[model samples]
Target: MLQKAFKRYIDSFRGFSKEIWILALITFINRTGTMVLPFLSKYMKEDLHFDYDHIGTVMVFFGLGSMFGSWIGGKLSDKMGFYKIMIFSLLTSGMLLIFVQFVTSFIGMCFAMFGIMLIADMFRPAMYVSLGAYAKPENRTRAFSLVRLAVNLGFAAGPALGGLIIMGIGYKGLFWVDGASCIISILIFATLVKEKKLSTHENHEDTEKAVVKSVFQDGPFWIFLFGSYLTALIFLQLFSTLPLYHSEWYHITEFQTGLLMSLNGLLIFFLEMPMVTFLERKQVNRLKLILWGTFLLSLSFFVLLFDNWAGILIVSIIFMTFGEMFNFPFTNSFAMSRAPKGHEGRYMALFTMSFSLAHITSAKLGLGIVSRHGYTTNWLVMGILGLLSCASILYLKRIVAQSK
Candidate 1:
């Protein structure tokens, strides 16, 4: 019985190629260096002395850059090839981070954050395109989950180490470390990855037609993107609002907060792959997973309503991580499956844009609610949003089924 279980566990990783692993490695390295964004609110509040509104505005600027970056990355990946985009995003974003260390004024910091994220987030669409290009159809969900595993593993390390590093070298150290990781990943990718050939079979008329057909034209996908946007808005609260609430309400230190945040990644690292593998073996419906995931995610936020106890926070984090495991990997696979041939990058980009939209909106909206009502209000709002997203996703499933 144990041997059979072990065999099934190994089978989850069956279809990934050397390229997929290398890409996953690059993802791990990049995410491991993900020391800056998660802690940006703390740095702004403590170091720069920015208030909640100021931080929200800055985050919105960052979101603007990210949203534009994702859209452009998607469009450009189709035209320029994903390999070139990946190499450029990594190198340029790394170099840009060094400049982030020196910004002094509010406007200057906002612009710098915008530029950094614009370059940094261009990798999303390119990475998605690369994963789709590399993995087989039957194995695509597991492939995405594997890459997310690499990400979660890196995230597991990044914050815990970041907490220690911040204690020693201050916020500038975060920028330096983040920049170095991007550069290191560049070297690994450039050394190992051969440039992928773009589709060359199209005639002039077909090529012209392809250029005109955009990912936005798909109505059901638009609904899906909206639902994804709502879910992302709630999930991103972990980064945007939760840390601030911990510090202000619980008087938690930055290091402790980092440790708490790490719990989300750690839980996903251990459980996501195994859970996905088991669900696959059981042949679970993909749409059902997403719906349930959204519902659970909302419940995670609602868990925080019992905020009198520290233990409740831990429970909420665990629930949220389980929700993420259900939502993200399967959603990515579903998006890839929905892509019209030859436009995968654009489809992936629009989907990625959903998160970017969340980034832009969540911080500002969350901080506004916290400023006006209270932290509890923010959690309640997020829970409501999640419930709405569940409905949207259910509708999306119906649309997807009809199209099929």
Candidate 2:
């Protein structure tokens, strides 16, 4: 059964060359190493004894850096080509990581944080921008699903690997691992990643000014951009604040805490493809599926405040995981579908920017709500936000219909 399943997945993406697979694997490597930070925060606070404000400050720097990087990357990808942009960003980030380990002071760490995040996130917009050239629209969502699955598989391994590295060697060791992985990816990319450039293939103007106009010319582009930001901000609080809620309210151990996150990633890895297949077969509207996903995700956080043990956490995860299967891939597919001809990089860059911007804004908003009003109110506010996001999608869908 497993053999047949693997063969079928191989057959599905006949458009993608071996180079694309390597690109995907490189993505998995980068994401896996980067995913260590969420778990690293716990070590920083609990073991190293940093205060909450310091943690928040570090997050702020990371977010701001990523926001700036995404914009810069988008513009660069439109002119310089995807592989070039991605390689430079990754190598720069890796070099920064080597420096991050030496910082023991607060001010020093903040500066390092900004540099690391800026470079790490710069690669993302270029990465997404590249995808438009490689895969067909009908299979685009599936392509994203497979990519997410790859990242999740890497994500699932990363925390445990980080944990063991922390246990055996030290916290600094994690950064070393991340830096080494980035170096390896940079080398692989230089050799194997030659999927034709989005700009030259699409004949986008090679000038910087031209690339800037391409990203923001249309009004609806901005609308979807803001929508993607909201979607990311409202949903991603699960990683940052959820653990705090579980720890303070339920007093769960650090091990169990990491385990719950692993559960989220694990669920995505095993179930995403099957869920996407089911939705496709049902002829479900992608927009509706995403909206439903938003509701379920919001509901998960709201319901969790009432649970006493891990059981409730597990149940809540089921909702969020269900939401993820539809919410993540469809939104990405929508971004690709909506791009104007010959401007794939611009649209994909916008999509990446929106999502990256949300991470920055949500760090402030999600943390502020939970820190101020308590977990119950935090969950409630996020639910309201999620519903508002759904309304935006519904409005967009309606507008599209009226135009037709």
TM-score (C-alpha, index-matched) for candidate 2: 0.86
Candidate 1 residue-wise lDDT, 1-404, digit = tens: 98976786677777677888899899999999988877888999999999978887888888888988888888788888888889999999998987787886789989998888787778899889887677665566788999988887888788878888899989889989999999999899999978765433322211112122657677777888888899999998987789898889888898887777778767776677778878866867787999999998999999999988877878888888889999998889777666666787788889898999887788778988999999999999999999999999999778766655
TM-score of 1: 0.88
Q: Pick the candidate with the highest TM-score.
A: 1
RMSD of each: 4.4, 4.5
lDDT for each candidate structure: 0.83, 0.72
Where does model 2 exceed 4 Å of error?
1-16, 39-51, 199-214, 278-283, 305-310
